[model samples]
Target: METISKIELRNLQIEDYLELRASMIEAYSGIEDAPWKEHEIKKLLSIFPQGQLVVLADEKVVGCALSLIIDDKDIDDNHTYEEITGNYTFSTHNPSGDIMYGIDVFIHPKYRGLRLGRRLYDKRKELAEQLNIKAIMFAGRIPNYSKYAEEISPKQYIEKVRMKELFDPVLAFQLSNDFHVKKIMKNYLEGDTHSLDYAVLMEWNNIYYDKSPKLINSEKSIVRLGLIQWQMRPLKNLDALFEQAEFFIDAVSGYGSDFALFPELFTAPLMADYNHLNEADAIRELAKYTEPIYQKFQEFAISYNINIITGSMPNIIDGNLYNCGFLCKRDGSSEMYTKIHITPNEVAHWGMKGGDVIKTFDTDCGKIGIIICYDVEFPELSRLMADEGMQILFVPFLTDTQNGYTRVKSCAQARAIENECYVAIAGCVGNLPRVNNMDIQYAQAAVLTPSDFAFPNNGIKAEATPNTEMTLLVDVNIDLLKELHEHGSVRILKDRRTDLYEIKKK
Candidate 1:
């Protein structure tokens, strides 16, 4: 550790965040035990305006201390605490909720000899006084400073302490800042030191009182998503369609795509003309043609062991003709959704209006939803599903016009961004010679993200060839969506004028 004198101290400003983050990443380049992330820093900023205390050598930040005010009044008022059995429980009554929690302290590797970590804590204590927070509490990873020294592997340190790491630098720093170890949390992560892995909860009282909370712009959040792009054909010729579908199943399952989707009517052929066929007759024909194909698909899914969206196909339930999508999992559980939006041509040809409701369901990847062909054009349906916490919208369509396809694809992307979810569109691309001379083309596959939108960082993450039968793959992180949704960054669920929309509904 090298010693340096020209250290400047200050609170974090908005402009300083990115720079400070880049520096932290650089400083901890080779230290996995001292991992720091931008999102965590952002969360600190959101909870505390002056929570970040920085030390500058010359003009750059070389250290940081994170602290947050926890009002005893607020704490006392809350009835529950996070507990071991995965439940919240009320244990005791408190006089007030005014408390300050010291989260972490960071010092640049180059300036380790300056004892700057202590200085930052002193500043944090001073701020606690200014905020009038009556009590302070914190936790730390055991074994402290010796744990992070280059000579000591974390594994070795755990053996020395006969304990596991309860916290990191942040928790350990709290120990020297007048907080004591109160509890031990064990085996937090695999391969961590047993004794030191437990967190030592500590508390301090009567630091400060009655300070107003200020606006905080930095909040830790992430957007998670699940994407499934359907790319399979539904034709009467069972052999050829099944073959095409096998390739798709391979592409999706091979990459372990969170979910893989197929087009509407994916494994069944359309009738040349439905003029004489009753609803029952049409569906019977489809079932007769598709039963074997579906059985094979189920087997394929089991072999690959992946979630598959069996795109819409003509089905007969109680003698009613319907277009339905099937949600199939590796464990063999399956559910179906009848298309809620039927086109005029579809109704004229099949004598069906539309299905009744929308659906969102749980899957191994996360909660997902399905909106068939024309159903996607209705923004209300997508918004309803979004409001229900649907993180991925899978669409299966067959269209002829480039304009219509582009419009639907763009709508899917817009819905995804507005909802802070992922939108995946899969359309039929090959020829359907029996229907008409019309050449089918559409957004065969697309993955839209919040970053792709016009609003700063919401938009499309990936999209497939406009008119090709290729399988697209993307890794979906569903946790990120939950963060974005909770924070109201993308404002898909929030910021809506429900009152006004209600009047329009009337």
Candidate 2:
């Protein structure tokens, strides 16, 4: 005897007919049967290839299961196997049928005693769930019934098997696999003497069936994004920052936005009075308010019932200055992502260093990635987040010129297309006349989507007036991203040449 190395179950293909036919012939060798022609198998495949399946061990076809879809209402009260299936021609396969009718399950003689039948049944159940059908139904053979046909009727024989007082090589196996006997059928098969031409109608209901398009595109499947175009004004103190933050929170939460985002270093206004200090000292002064800002945002998130990505704040942790963004959840819990890419101005002027770790945050809406300003300019950072199952990318940026703003905007749009994910960018606008290194700001808040028919014409779902002090809110459908990855005109995520090159994160 040889051991099975690996088993693979897949949809039936026309090329599998030769091996499947041979297996069917061998499995029904000593029983009365009509051989299935090649055209019949091809017809079945042409109608619904998903309903037919084959199991392979080391590339050898050892088991097969065939099925067809049918409407339950069309099945008559006293339907025979031939009447229900059109004498095995399968011309009755209804594409919109709610019930999946299992036509046959056969295992090669050499593959017997290996529990291959169980594998075939499991595959059928999987197909039912994928199609979101009502139930799996078929007429099961009572193979050992011929021996006891004179002792009892078919219904009585089935009851004994159900009661465990008798054994049915076929019905017992079907029952163990959760198929309940609905009733007995007479003359179910044309030439089945072993079963005395009697079979049991069986069904396995799919209790978890769901097939509504609204359910797929519901609010449960969307992530509402709120982008804040912060006004670059002089901040007298942290109270001024609080006033502006509360205003945006109140405005966006009124519309039920899930995540509210602010611009990078939006809290820099809090250090407006310390502008007389050197550039490095002034940024460090902003860092001192990081703890208080984090605590305030945490409270705001709970009070407004929204998750707040408080943009990027300067943090002087362990004597090293880093740009960090906090994601405060509605429950008052928060996490932070440090900017992994530092700009030339950041390093030369503010003595800022880049972070080492790249991560994504899990929320009620979806998995999100927070990348700040220049970090979005690097493709690998967004790719890493996408690989980690980030369906939405949030960028909090601060740029003083239109050229710098374009860099962030273009890269953000490109990332959305490449990864097939939503990207929301928020930035600061207006002139902070007194704050060094942040005196001038050029900003626009926009929600960018992949370039597809399901999306907007310019790949932007929503945007604020350039350099305006306003909040932009947009609802992004995560399901649309899923559909694009599967059925878009150009599936960038699925068409990646992983064999040629891969994105490996260290």
Root-mean-square deviation per candidate: 19.1, 18.0
lDDT of 2: 0.85
lDDT of 1 by residue, 1-506 (tens): 44332345688765666667766776656445444455555555565667678877656777776665554444322121233111211222122346666555567677664446766765666665665556666554454634455577554543444343444544544554566554544443223342234444566655334456543222212222223333323344657676767776766654535466777765434444431466445545765555465566555554455567777777667777778767766444567788887888777656564678676888655677888978888887877777676877888776768887877877877777666777777776765544432225455577777762232353666667666657777655565676676664445577778877731221
lDDT of 2 by residue, 1-506 (tens): 23453456688888887887777888789864544688988899889988888887667787788899999898765688788888778888999988999888887878666556776786688677767788999988888999998899888888899899999889998998889988788888868889888888899998767756122222467667888999988777788889988999989987768899999998877777787899999889889899988888876775566789999999987889999989988644689889988988899999998898888899878798999999888899888888888899999999999999999999999999998999999999998777887889999899999999999989999989999899898998888998998899998877889999988778
TM-score to true structure, per model:
0.50, 0.58
Look at candidate 2 and tell me the lDDT of residue 83: 82
Mark the regions of model 1 whose C-alpha exceeds 4 Å error after superposition. Answer: 1-236, 268-284, 435-439, 451-458, 488-490, 499-506
Alpha carbon lDDT of residue 154, candidate 1? 50
Q: Best TM-score goes to which candidate?
A: 2
The number of clashing residue pairs in each candidate reads: 59, 0
Which one is best on lDDT? Answer: 2
**Residue 423 of candidate 1: its Cα lDDT?**
77
